[model samples]
Target: MKELKHLNKYFKKYWFKLLIGVLITIIARIFSLIMPSYVNKSIQAVEEFMADTISLSEAKGMLLQYILVIVGAALLSALFTFLMRQTIINVSRYIEYDLKNEVFDHYQLLSLNFYKKNRIGDLMNRISEDINQVRMYAGPAIMYGIQTLTLFVCLVPLMFIKAPTLAAYTLLPLPILSVLIYQISKVIHKRSTKVQEFLSTLSTFTQESFSGISVIKAYGIEPRINAELRVLANQGKDTSMSLAKVNAWFFPLMILLIGISNIFVVYIGGRQYINGDIESIGVIAEFILYVNMLTWPVAIVGWLTSIIQTAEASQKRINEFLKAEPSIKNEVLQPTVIHGDIEFKNVTFTYEDTDITALKDISFKVKAGQTVAILGKTGSGKSTILDLVARLYDVTSGEVLIDGVPVQKLNLNSLRNSIGAVPQDAFLFSDTIENNIRFGNENASHDEIVAVAKKAVVHKNIEGFAKKYDTILGERGITLSGGQKQRVSIARALLKNPQIYLFDDCLSAVDTETEEEILNNLKKVSESKTTLIVSHRVSSAKNADKIIVLDNGKIIQEGSHQELNAVDGYYKELYLNQLSGKE
Candidate 1:
């Protein structure tokens, strides 16, 4: 219940709708109460007729009136019960939507470090499975809790007013029932939390397996995957069954206690009637109906508690992420203009998770319209330089500046929107080729998409397909070849037409001839944009205005390509090696 307090704002938002539902539940219960009173009256009428206190015709008339009133009251009760669902359940759905959106929005605001700390499937579980449990508390549990309280408040006083002694006997088992439910509810809460945790584990395993299905098949490891799934499935089933076993105790216990209550009513009432303490048998019948009326609300007590405990556990998980502060905060809300004059002065960065320093006293600058090529061996910090400029990872010690202003001081959205980056992996979405390209520019026309595709030298390849740009790609653009995916990703960035361009080995997948053509096209489009090219090939850097060579997270060589070619350095040796290979 403490964890569930997180949803108080949502409760306040829909308080009016819940208030209406409460009034309806009360009115419906009152209407339902009319029947028992009428049942007593109808029985009394028969007794009067048997004792000859009234004419048979008059008794028949009274019975008919009572029957009509009873039926009308029952119908009114049924109608209001329907309205109760419309109000309370619908509010639950509204709250669910708001909660899901809130979690998702928070997820987007979190930094890359947070994603590194968490799993995709676990994140997905919190938004979907965890929120669903909380919704049950918002809707059905609250509705039934109100109904139960209403019955107890309205029914208890009337039961005593009718027959205090009988009421006393009938409610004797309730205290014991309450104590049992409290003990059982504690167990239920513990088990519920375990079930939720296991579900998340199962989800993560399934998602990872599906994403790596190709790798598993390539290695002929289907049996190994199946064995791992079996282990996860067994654990999941055991947790779920443990929860079910405890839940199984609730309904049977309720029924048994209710049956004891029924026994008390009949046995006590009969004794009273026989001992002349009661006026008529009709009183006995009315008390029986009263006890019966209490049966459902009482039985639902255990169920309502179960739902509440489960919701509390789930909401606790949801609250954990909601309370997390993003590592990177937006210092400026108002938009700031970006001209792409990027600079990093005395920058150093260490990966927090692995504690590996990706950059060591790194420093570089690119003017508003200059092409810089960074050449390095794998793990030599070339990508880290581009990442620092893009502000993906903040520098551990030093400054990242754009147009002489600190990068952190600038508006995050404005800065990101100004830069177009094609990542090392060239990721794309599972959507139409046109839609994937349009992700960079949502309002881009079909002609603009085609134009960028041609600039990236992928237009003819796309046009060769039957659907051209309309072809649907599989997850992560799996439907396309590695080279085609890289080309499409390049086209997406070109479509953004940002002030700063980052090509992170985007040409590695394509052949040398195609890479040359794409580079020629990029040179045209990036004429006045600050562009950083990270690559292993000497050809990619041979024509740049400046070439930087890095080794082990430190810049070892920096000069023009021709200048470096003349010097005795790694750059010269690499150029000669590639040139000899070309011959």
Candidate 2:
């Protein structure tokens, strides 16, 4: 219910449409209920003829009128059913669209830490399966629910009027049915949640296996991977079977209750007629018709309850996602544009659940139009510093300032929009090469795309493809080599033409010769914008205007290439080791 309440934003927009739909549904159900009265009238007319109160021809005429009334009611019921589906069910679709869009929008606002902790498959499940479950509640569940409720509202009093004692006896099983539904609904909710969770696990496994299929093939471990996949699939199947078992037990009990109620009506009404307490067979026929009318609507309770419970579970998951507070929130006032003057004032950052700080009391400043290279070993804080600059993560202590304003206080979109970042692992969608390069700037011309590709030293390789820029890539751009992916990512960043640029070991996959060539081409691109490069190779950092050497999360040296090369420290040691390896 809380999850449904959270959807009030969408409800507000479509409430009027839903109101009109409900009215139509109620009118339709009323027409259907009135047809049972026609049955009563027809029987009454026949009874009158048998008692010599009416001629056979007159009774036949009355029966004919009731037959036409039944036909009209049936036709009107079908028409409103169509109208309600068009209105309410269509509204559910619109709301689903709105809900999915909002969830995606909120996901974009969340900090990188959130993605680091959450799986892509789990998020995908919430978007797809969970949202669809919510839609069922909105559409078919609510539609039938209203129809069933309307029948009770219209038919119950009429059932009493036809024969109060019979009505009371027939309804005797309902309170027990209510209790059974309440208890079974709890089990359904719990089992449905487990099934959904297992489904998400299966989704995660499938996504991971497909994404890593190349590695599995290269390692010749398909059997091992398949075995692992089977484990997850089996778990998913077992949970689903468990849910089905509960449903299996509940449905029969529901059918039994319906049968028991009907049995009571027939027995009690038959006895009353024989004992001469009732008027005639026509009255008993009307009472039986009313009970039959009540049957399906009451039976539908089991189905509607299941839908509602599933929705409740799905909504709980969706609400957890929606209610998650983004670690980063942009609440700054009139934040000035970033001119790429970045500073870290004794910044310290420790990742969640880690005792040691990733970046310890780090302080540095890069002026506009400067290229600063950070050189470090495997676990050094080079990438952490760049992460702070992009505000992918805020500093755990101290401050990061861009153009004199605190990075935290700056507008998030404006801040991120100002920077272009290329990470070590280049990820691209399955799309045309042209589209991948144009991802940073969708409005970029073909000429502009080719220009950036050439600058990143990837144009020649792209031209070698069968369709050149139009060549479609596989998942994660896996059709391309590692070096090609890196070059494409670099070209994507180059196309952005941002105020600041960050390259975190993006040249690692390329050969040193190709790396040098790409670096030489980027000299012009790096001239006016602030640029930060995190690399382990001396070739990548040797020509930088400034170099910062880091070790164990602390800056060990800071100077130009020659200045650091002349020093007797970690930088000098790294230079000597690489130079000797070359010789």
Candidate 3:
């Protein structure tokens, strides 16, 4: 409900239209009520004239007036219907725009941990399906509810005027109907909530399966994946059927109550006509018209109840997401420009739901414009250091500082924009090469992009493609080879020309010759910027200003490659192995 209050802005924008629509609807209902009275008066006039109790000329005049009234009421109804539809539909569109913008903004502000915890498909469902449910209630349900209330107010007065006794009898079943609607609505709300949850689970499963289809096929586990998918599909179907069942029972029960009310109107009004207590056939006929008007309003009670319940469930989910607090938030003050000097001081970090520390009591410093190589065995927290430096996650204890300012105090955008990273598994969108490069520098010139691609040694390979820079890569760059994709990613990062660069095994996919070319390019680029390279190859770390060896989340040795090779330790052992392999 608190999340729904955010819609007040849209409400303010459309308030006048809604007011006009409601006013018109009330006027229309009032005019419609007059038609029944006219029918009764016209019939009584004709009968009196035929019985010679009134003159024919007077009856003719009365008939003309009644005909005009009926035509005017029909016109009013049509006009109000148009106005209500136009206003409510536009309101729905405005609310949709607001909800989408809010969701997108929230996504951007959320921490990396949030993304790690929630699946992409689940987020999509919140933005699409859940938002649509809210729109349905806001627009059509609210509009119809207003229409019903107007009809009830206008028709009840007329009913009392025509035959107060019959009107009183007709209302007897309404309280029972109200209780039934309330109970059914509660059930619908509970079931609809479950349905939305199941839909999210189904969407998550579908997205995961499709994204990992390559792995599934490679491992020959398609049958296992399919079975898992079937389970999720059945769960979704069960929840949907449960909701449909609630509607099925609720609608019929509503109709039965309405039918009984209609029958009572006919039975009691007929006796009044026979006993002469009611004046004429016209009176009974008008009473029936009023009763017919009551029918839709009664039916609408069920529809409105269901709509509100569904909307409430959707709002609850949306509210939970909106209320989620990001683990990382911006600093109160903007930080000064960074000079790329980074230090890790007695830092310790452990991921959520884990006991082992990823990095413990780690201390290191890299000066500006120096190349540092982090040599480590797998799972030695090399990549975790880069992630921490980028503030993807906060340290569990101690501090990481950038240019003398604590990383937490620095402006997040300024901190991240100052660093460029090429990860182990490089990813690209299904877009042109030019567009992908432009992601690093949106306004980069074609020549500038080509220059950076040359530095990454990828330009020649790109030129071999039919469309070259304009070629659209397949989804996740699947159309390109692993080395080509990695080089493209490198080219993109190089284009940024950041103060600090991180290469996390980015050259692993390239051949020895291509890897040497990229390393040569990096050697030239590293002269005026801070660079950190995480690699397993001894040859790659040989030229670094400083090389640090890590094992089991702790640094085992730190020195130049020649100095580490001088010692009979892990570095020397690695060098011997590589040299022996070459021999």
lDDT of the candidates, in the order given: 0.90, 0.87, 0.84
Question: Which pairs of residues have clashing backbones in candidate 3?
Answer: none
lDDT of 1: 0.90
Which has the greatest lDDT? Answer: 1
In candidate 3, what are the lDDT values of residues 114-157, reduced to their tens digit? Answer: 88788998898999999999898778887878878988877787
TM-score of each predicted structure versus truth = 0.97, 0.93, 0.91
Model 2: residues >4 Å from true position, as ranges?
47-57, 274-280, 333-335, 580-583
Ranking according to lDDT, highest score first: 1, 2, 3
lDDT of 2 at 327: 85
Candidate 1 per-residue C-alpha lDDT over 114-143 given as tens digits, one digit per residue, 9 for 90 to 100: 999999989999999999999999999988
Model 2: lDDT equals 0.87
RMSD of each: 1.5, 2.3, 2.8
Indicate which candidate wins on TM-score: 1
